[model samples]
Target: MALIQTSLIWVAYAVAVVLLLIIATVFVFIYQTPRDRAVSVTTVCIFTMSALLATVLLMPVDIALVSSTSNSAEGRKKDWATPNEIDSIIKTLKIVYYTLYSLDALLCLLVVPFTYFYYEEYDEEATEVGDQTLGTRLWGAFKYTIAFIILVVAIFLIGFFVPYAKQAKNDGRLDLDYFQRLLLQNRGERALSFALGLLMTLGTIIYVLYTGAGLALLPVALIKSAPTVSAPTLAANTASQLEENRERQRQLDGRNEGRENGLESRDRRELEALIREERTLIRRERLAAESSGEDRHWLIKAWIKVEAVFRPLKLIGGLLLLLLALFVFVSMFITAVDKAKNSICGAHCGYILGYLNIFQPINYIFVKSSKVFPIDYILFLLLVLFLFSASVVGIATVGIRFLWITVFKIRKGHTSPQALLMATVMLTLITLAINYSVAMLVAPQYATFGHQTFCDRAPRHPGEQPDCTHNHKAIRPCTEMSKNAVAKDVCTPSVLSTFINGVTIDFPFFGLIMFWAQFAFLGVYLVVFVATLFKTPKMDEDQLDADLEEDEEEGLLASTGKRFGATWQDITGHARTPNYGAAETNGERA
Candidate 1:
């Protein structure tokens, strides 16, 4: 029965793999169209999906391998695959996932510049089609070559600062003893992180409150500063708008009138339809031409602005992201190495695999609160996972918006103040919400999953499975095992114990590394966005006034606050007396 079940699992895995291949083929077909300008985003999405699909497929294979054991006739245990073979396969799969994730991140970074350059090139070509000198073209090509060289150099410099090669010296293995000692040596770092996070949180709250109050008072300020327009000017402006609307109405009526002038009813209907279709086609062509012209104009302006503004930021942003990625990569390598050396079941190796898991919300907070707020370890882990999902999904929502902007050529909206404000609010909210959620939901459920899963296992021996609870579950769970624990019991509170200022604490090394890495990425994003906001242009006075007027006309807001006399009249349901001579003349004119 077991053998049959294992065979079914393998078959299911094969079917899933085949389905993934078919989906990939479909993506390939979609990518082949020349007019499919969304290819970049589509390609990245498909590749990331494929990576996730592959990871899911490999998980079942791992489970099957772990569960497949045979009983021998001589009363000895046998296995289908050796531990070494299974470990090798698991490690290889892990490497594949890690590489896919890194590539996905790199693609995200690359898309911004690539999209900018693409539109710039398109604009240049559109301009140079009819009248471009050879010298000018050559100069353009020369500049492009220089820019490409600089981009390559920039990427290299960014990668150089990552320290990956240094960490890889010990085959990416993390020495727990060395790490613990380093923690003691660098006590100031942990304190600084906590201090910075707390300060930032308070600062953000204060800023929000202050800003909200200011916005609430803005209408009063606007009312006080409202400009006065003469009655004749207002009337003239209103008359001009009315005249424009009348003209449009006349044109629409003329079309209807023309349609009614036909002889036969069927012929009249068909002819009217044909004429309407022709008019529609012409209108569409005109609109498309105007749109293309506008796009070309804006593309040139945007490209110039991008160069003047964001080009300077590229090096700084790249370096920051690079450093953060490397930090995460090193931490992941360390975790994997520790798990392998300890011979823990790969399924229970930390919370998740690769640097992607670092983006999860679970972190040092759980470790810090576990002692003070106790609960089931399994429940705590699940809560952490849930928070991780929510936070990552929120971040991805913003990311997808960016992808859409690039793919759809929505460059004009990219640097708007409203967009920047929204981005800031969303990011800040996500950060705060995740921290609070983890504290409230996950922290209270914290138990000794780490110790139970790692410590209470049997000693390593030849031809024997490692002390993995999942592999050999005759050993009691951590909760039961730790209850009767003595000084000699393996069910200790900590898995990788460390000293912080001579105080022993169960150091959540993986969690802290990931948490800091997240902060580093957020820091880079915040700096870049704030800088961009500063660089972006504001609407001129005329445009601002026009927008305000439109909003007021649409009943969105009051143009001006009423005076005290008017307010009193409104409250009392009273009418003000008018000048009799002026009123008599106005009535006669009407």
Candidate 2:
């Protein structure tokens, strides 16, 4: 029986993991698509709505489980004498069941219908492209609405009426045990039936309201606007606008080319004069320089000084950014660990710890004992240390490179190859550290619970165990059982441990991959920066003058045209902007 139970549980867990992975991959693919902004926004809105519905339904279940375990009777039968635990549990169950029914009704009757309408509106313009007539689309929508309403009503009936009727079957005679009767007569049963009925009636009313609203609004909109322009009129208008734009563009291009030609002519003349002057100076200095044996040493000294100052500053800035990135990564890692610990270690250490182990496969190995390692904090510290070490190495490399370039007056661009090598080394170190950290954090959490021995022994059967040893003495098993039996007996643990372990296993590796990917981007940027620095420099004055002239020409062209053009005035016979009509002239004498 235990083997069967464990196998089934494992199968369910595997199925869930596969489903989640598929869902995540699908979403990632959708997000990567180059869809238009409106389509992407609509997709995100729908996804968010679905996620919210799922979260709302699942959160209640989680709460019920936690509440039930926390308030369970000491012995299984102890809760039989006091009805409150059973009553509270039944109440919670009913609330959860009804909430699910309400959500189903909402999705089918409200969200689905609303989504259909929204899609219809969005696709209205595209209907003609696919040769789909408006009447056909409307008919399809009507059929969908009817089907959706039927499904919602069916779900409501099945979810509420089945449970209610089953309770009625068990309770009508009042011959069963106290617990059975209590379950049959609970308030939750009544609530579910009532809510289900209300939802069905409400959904019908809403459908009627939607039809009436659509009828009233459609004609008003149609009356306020004439039938849209025919195809021929649209085509003619588009062609005419295209022609007008072409003409305007031709005129603008002509003016630009003429201005460019004039600038070129002036530049050519200036260049010729500068060349002649350079030749004249060369001729005058050639004889004297040849005789004196003088050299231009100052220029080389100045270039070396400029390179010295700039190199250190660049290295320092790069190191600072790298360190900041590492710090952020470490902080996020620590926060994840702390959250996992708090979630796993609730108020009752022994019970909660056992519950957590159910989800973590590693707990199976250690389930026989109570002794557990403080692995969560240790994993967190190791991650921090790895990130800190990487940061230190990065800072040190930057400092060493700075010293080599500035103090040593190394040849221009000579330190770049060394810098690249250091970056590669840092990248490798960080990658390995991150991998090790992730492995340490994730692998141990999944290990079997083989380390703890005390937990292995069975408590003497309930009646033989000491009263003081049990926390909930009122519970049947604890009050009546021998210590040996109670210790040996095992109950199913909570699945929360699996969830936390799964997160630890997946997130760190994924984070490390992302970190390395980001480093690749930084490396590419650095390579580009180095290339730019080593490339030939251009004369600044000529580039500045050309930029200024381009700006001036753009400004002139922009100011030359009215936004709406002359045709707009001719058609409207008035300007769009406010105008104080010349003070209405009246014959002053009159």
Candidate 3:
């Protein structure tokens, strides 16, 4: 227990370090790329806020948890923190976590589906940029952002509050129902808020659709827009074309002279056919190369590769989550049945309620001591089988798919070796999380009981006196009976209590361990994923977006202002400033 506690403390420290590193990295990027001021600011704010929230909210929980676990295990009465303090910290953590969870879901709902529509509109040019009003776009963006925020808050209530309310109702320690009542009242308020928010979001969308505008305007207002392409300089292009024609004419003239001199006689029809074929092939290649396409940075390519591999795993995940939910439901059923049987039986075969008699045999075979065929054991075996089967199927399928994706994406120049290296690390971490969760569920049941011993009064004891210091009050012989006996308590208390208490403590810790472990793993994973996917340094080499390069060059002047004490206000003005060069060039093309 001490070792485990110590290990957990270290793990917490590791988590803190990792989170701090992420915060530092975000700030560093913001500092380095003042040109991407809007984007960098948004990124910094989100991450900084998240980190602050985590630190303030989770630190206390960690402290309380460590103290509680250590004191409880050592049987100490001293209080580093009271139970109330611990409970409060945990409650706060849950509230904040769930709130953030709702926001995450809200973002997904708003961004992903709408993004598809936005792209479709952009591709078709359904709404001409020149025709759209700036005020309309800004108003639409603001309305939707507000609506999403409100709707997310409402979602937080519906998803988290109702369930927590139900749970609190069962908590015997809560001396008053006042808090629970408050929660119910708040739920109603949140529901109302949610409705209003939904209406606002929908209303804005409808108005936009009616006005023949696109949701593309909303994201464009929020996130930085892609650099617009400018027209080619005609003078330079014409000059280059003329030069190329002159060179071609010279080559033709040389070929004619050679033929006239009879030094190089050839089939004229075949030569013309070959020249036509060559020109057609060159034209096709040039067209393919000139097609408008987004840049594929290393990280984006890596993601594309990873997505191809894990696309099928979405179905696998759904199946696994469904199976896990079923398992939990069955476990709950077993628990309820056990509780009911125990209550009616009263730790002995006392007169059970008549209605409950139907399940008496089930109680006996499963919950009770005696079993004819170990039906309960068979249930345990089935659980094991299912767990093993599900894990094996998931891991094997994902691994095989990853290998295929790696090979395929590498061939397509979409995945780098470094990306695969990071991917392998991710897989290992995922495996650890999955296996650890499963083991936590199953390991306690088969834990070793304390050393065997016979009480002094028992026969065939070989004269070896049992150490019943912890079990003396509970130990009794089988023959010692009365009209009713509490058969459940007829065990060595030392061993039984140790086993029972350990398992009990492990149950909640399972969730706690899984939470923080995944938290740390994901922090690392996101850093690697994002660094590989986006970021300017890694992307510049691709040269996929010529306009993007120009934007960066223009941004250099804005970034320089940062060194001379320019504020966000200054950066904002700079972003709004039009690039007359680009606009004039585009006008020429028009």
Candidate 4:
């Protein structure tokens, strides 16, 4: 039966993998297209559907494994049998589910980078049609490579530490049976479960909160400012300009009609001619005025003024996001400090020691409070804000620069594409540094708190002294606890290892690394776009003439070459022109 079940599990895994691959291939094909409104909508729909299906399929396996072995008997004997089997299965399922979910998250994050890349490449290809420059493309490739390296390192460290922290929580639960024994003698398992549960639950909550907050900020930052001119406004302006021109033409025609009526026969003829000339002059004036007005309306200078007015709004939005992210960071730090204190002193030590110990008062506050606030939540929120702020700053900087370039026609001195590529690299590096610093600062808190719990478990080991327990007679020394209890207990080495592994994989550190890498790519693209805006190639008059002449010469050569290559009858038949000499002779004979 076990073998059959295992085989079934593998079959399910295979199906899921195949489905995911198919979905990913579809996305890849769509991603290769240039950005368009329809494509964006379609991409979002595809991603959401794929993720939903993957989640639905994944949840069943997790539920089945967890539910099947949840009530199994515990002991060394059981450890070698059903209990260990169940635990192993549950752990495997959890890891698999988390990994797939992370992949889902990654795919969603990838949309931005893919769009940016497509747009940038299209722009480059379109602009550099005649003179291909390899510098920008090469530099972009180099920047992506660097970003990928940073991402890998960050993910590795996150994956390494998270499991260790979870293991500490599981290990601390080893004294559960001992607590149950004490309970039969009128004691309780409250202390042991509380100690273990606090670390695991709190650590998870913190990580989730921080990650959620960070992700939430991305969309807010991306909200485009309301368009400066709506379609209706443009239409109204066009109608008004047309009306003004028509009124001027009508007045000119009335004046010409009056002059035409007051003349003698010869004078009247000349007057009619004068009226015709005057009407033409009026038409020319009307056309000149209309063209001038249209030019003024569409000038780059006008758009710059509009952008300038919107600048403050963007700055305000960006600053708010930054502040929110900063708040999350500070909150995470505080939570970490509290958790560390709790783990070191044990669950209720803060309450007992707080009045007596001035240095450790904070721990008491954390314990007596019914809810331990999650620092990670704050960190996640801050991350969201940070991303939002960074995006805003990036857009604003590029937008302003572009506006100036367009309005003022600023000259870019060099034709080197390398300059734009370098700017992109710099921007990407800056984004990575910022994200890394944030993660590093937040990760240590989770690690420190988790570690503190592991240390507290040391004293609870089977061989330790029994001074800590309330009932001396009822409690055996740590040394007296059976090997079976140590092996099969929740706090056993195996359980601890499993728990640590779980926590490490659950946190948002990996996601953050992926996000920052993509952000770096975006930054590079933005730099390229801004550089392109400022640099307009000088129009080569001589080159333009030479190109035109070359085209004419090619046409002439192609005609001659085709005629020469043709058979004589075919060439002569098509070469016959109008027989003008024959027509002239016929007319003379007639």
Candidate 5:
């Protein structure tokens, strides 16, 4: 029986890993595929798919932790024909967990970093690899991978190892044995990991909140936003835009071409901008010309129609996703606060999903869901996927948001190889953060869908389709339990609670961080949402209004004073100076 269950678990894992590979391959192919196809697509797929999968190896281990925390595994032990079977299953779980853990260390710390550089070396846009021989490129990527390893080690030292060393009072050893579950052995590492994960998780939260707001509001705004395009001027518009772009490019070339570092820094950036614009207009012109009456091919017309539908569908879907994400955030926030306040569960307390279990009050509706068997599990998985997909979307978009956004000044798009490397590293960190985010989202849906919880079979297996209250706790509190089928010490948590204690196995401080930091993340999210909601959406119109307001606010001499602010002369003399520039050149003509 143990072997059968173990084999089934591995089979499920295999299916999941394959699905992840497909998803990872599609993402990498879209984002990181070499522009210059010197490397085969097949090879890139194989390498990148392997790297992403290898880096993300802790899923099953964490799931096991969740199972243990809920005491579901203890409940499952009753089914074993022999007492040894429980031990056998546990031993198997530990073996698989450590195997993946060690392999993850090997691949994530060593192999994955090189994969990015090796792939990036073939990118024509990455000028750092310009004109280098294959051997030179290979050597550079190797050096880069080493540097990345050193950086990871340094972070490990600061975040985990140093603290662990101090706590253990053993200078030579570090707590690399991460096979812990709610045990307080390596508190330092857990706290630090929790902190780092908290920071990135907040970043992920902001990403989702803002994206959701934008997505929710975009579709209607877009449908109403009609551009004033002249039918006859399509070709003329492209020509003029291209000509203007080239003119700027020509000016930049002439100014910088003679310098030692030709077209470096901002000049290089401006040139690239010009080139991109030129290409965009050229493509637009071709498409516009082709679309003239019968000149448009049937394929082109079909694509155009498809795009019309596809664009709206995408936007609508984003809006729906945003709603779901907001609900998840609220649920998490509630769960955090409840855990911080209550500390431990009593009565029927273990698996609190907070707002995530909206279906609890209406349990009668889904009371029969347990009877659905595999269907119930499937539905539960779908809910998990939806919540998790939101987190993935947030991680994916966070880097892009940071890349493009600014506070006081406009940010130039990241076009340099250095920026590329930085983004990749950020991607790496956020990928780690996804585990925490997804874990936070996943625990709740089990209650919603009426899937089995620890209390489901507690105290002599109360009917299969148990209510949230019964499923949340056994017949009595752990302290009061006597002659019960469930373990005496394992307190079953209430399904009504948003977050269960001991849920976050590795990052034990996660609940506390979430509770304290709720203000910061939620505050930022609210600020962004409110500002976006009330503020003008049209940039050009806002700019025009501001310009007109500025012109109106100007006085004869005060306009100059406002422009440059109070000058040294004005400050020193205590004299309200007239427009200094205007006064200096007052009746002069060029």
Candidate 6:
């Protein structure tokens, strides 16, 4: 029965993987809007979905492996995958997991960086089309590949192996094999643990802030979605925008240097994009100003008037959402800190197999309150709702500053292929880091499935799993088996635990580096959030005006890419041409 089940799971997994890839490709190539936004967001969403699909598909088999041998647990033994059929199932899933993981990693690492540089427009007449040979294009990809490889190597050397290698000999790690030595080293893990804690702390901060924004806006967004309830909008100063567009065109022409003047390249692509966005904003504002609601029927006109009188409800609802977002975020963070401060875990523990833990206090409260008010249900509901909302906001949030730093984020509403690829690279790192952070945030619920705690499991025989659980209680920590040595009463790893451990897969160092880089983003999000508080956002300039479709995050690293464009233009003194060519009075840009 289990063998057939496993085969069915594999079949389903295959079908799902193909379907997901096709869907992602369709979204990217056919249906994407605001092209750069699609590139950045879809990359993360598709990869995350694929990871989740694998974990979910394997879960039933994992549960079956730990099923009780007898119907009743009075004298029954845990299956623990002891049967040959179960073992075969485990093997099948392992192969399936790694196969998908390898493909995902290949796409993220080798293919993404190569495309980032290789895929660019070339002018047919820039150099008589002679310089635009296959060799030149391949050279571009090769340089990017080599540079990316060098960066990865340097990160490992500096962040993990180099410092640890120096101390390895001093700690008599010479006695261990290379793999054992690296894995067994305590000093580096201490560094990594602290790094992980700091990262969770900062990620929580950004997460809560955006969630708050989403929740706050959600009320207004609901209101705006109505047929006649939209608040009046102010038109932009487009006369100035026209002047700005003219200046941009003049500057774009300056960068049309040499024979590339009218030929395709970065300059022309950018100028057209930038101008296109300016024109769009100008056109939108002009249309808004011209189209008054005077033509509406008497009933609709009356409805709008009545809705305006109730505008304060949106404000009240917005505040409640802000509070809810903060409450959820704080609960999740506290859970992590509580795990870090556990009697077994304490200051210097990574918890066996590097499990990120849960919100103990909140759980206890929910359990106690569950009997009275179904608080547990409410908690779960809030978590799902707010996290879903946060994910929506997060995709559009200007949190990935690598894109803002390395590539200038001109507010073009479209990206050149190179910019799109760069966004993908930045988003790949984000998907990994944010996934881990989110796993940690929700670990308590997911990791404790069908068990009390992740650490309260069967004891390891000496060097099996780390006693980062501290060998507390001396006796095995489970409920099913109280007698026989043969009794396999231990908890099987949870779906979350399996994914967390397997997510990083072969490269442990990559996890550490990705984490710390995310930590640095703490400051970026903090400044951005703080600025939002200090200055009223255009999105919220009027009454009840938030929308999910818009990227409302702002400040120096605004999601709209306003500040980035301003800063670049100021620094370069309005460069000759744009980032890509499209022949827009190209000679004057620079």
> How close is every model to the real structure, measured as TM-score?
0.32, 0.25, 0.29, 0.28, 0.52, 0.50
lDDT of 5 by residue, 1-590 (tens): 44554455456556666776666544433333132322433344444434434334334322332233332323332333233543454455545543543343444455656755776666455555466667866887798888767865665565453333222222112122211122343544343443444444444554344333333333323332222232224455566656667777778879985688676686676677677667666765663453231243343334433433344245455456556546555655655554445433211222223323233221222223433333333433444455334333333323334445621111111123323333333344434434344443323333322222333342435633222343444432121112333332233222212112232333334443443444454555555446545642332122222322232232211111121122222212222322225343211210
Cα lDDT, all candidates: 0.33, 0.32, 0.31, 0.33, 0.40, 0.40
lDDT of 2 by residue, 282-325 (tens): 43333222112123233323333333234324334435534443
* Cα lDDT of model 1 by residue, 182-211, tens digit: 233233333332322332343234223322
For residues 469-520, could you state the per-residue lDDT of candidate 6 as single tens digits? 3444443322212232322323333333344432222233434443334334
TM-score head-to-head 3 vs 5, winner: 5
Residues 1-590 of candidate 4 have per-residue lDDT tens digits of: 56565566467646664665465334323222222323443454345434534543443333233322321111112222365676677567646644544443333234334333433443455456844345654455445555545653454444344332232234443344432232221011222222222323332232232233323333233232322322223234334434444554455456567574644465445445545444433443343232223323232223333433443355355456545544544443443344334332223111101111122222222222202223322333344334433432332233213323521111112111222222222222233233323322333222112111111122354753222233324322111122333322322222222222222223323322332333333334344434433532112112223322332332311121222212222212222221235344211311
TM-score of 1: 0.32
Query: Which runs of model 6 end up more than 4 angstroms from their true locations?
Result: 4-80, 83-93, 96-104, 124-131, 152-282, 285-330, 351-392, 395-413, 448-489, 494-590
Q: Candidate 2 regions off by >4 Å?
A: 1-93, 108-110, 121-143, 155-590
Residue 352 C-alpha lDDT in model 1: 21
**Ranking 3 against 4 by lDDT, winner:** 4
TM-score of 4: 0.28
- Indicate the residue-level lDDT of 371 in model 3: 19
Candidate 3 has an lDDT of 0.31
Cα-lDDT of candidate 1: 0.33
User: Model 4 residue 108 lDDT?
Assistant: 29
The number of the candidate with the highest TM-score is: 5
- Number of the top lDDT candidate: 6
Q: Sort by lDDT, best first: what order?
A: 6, 5, 4, 1, 2, 3
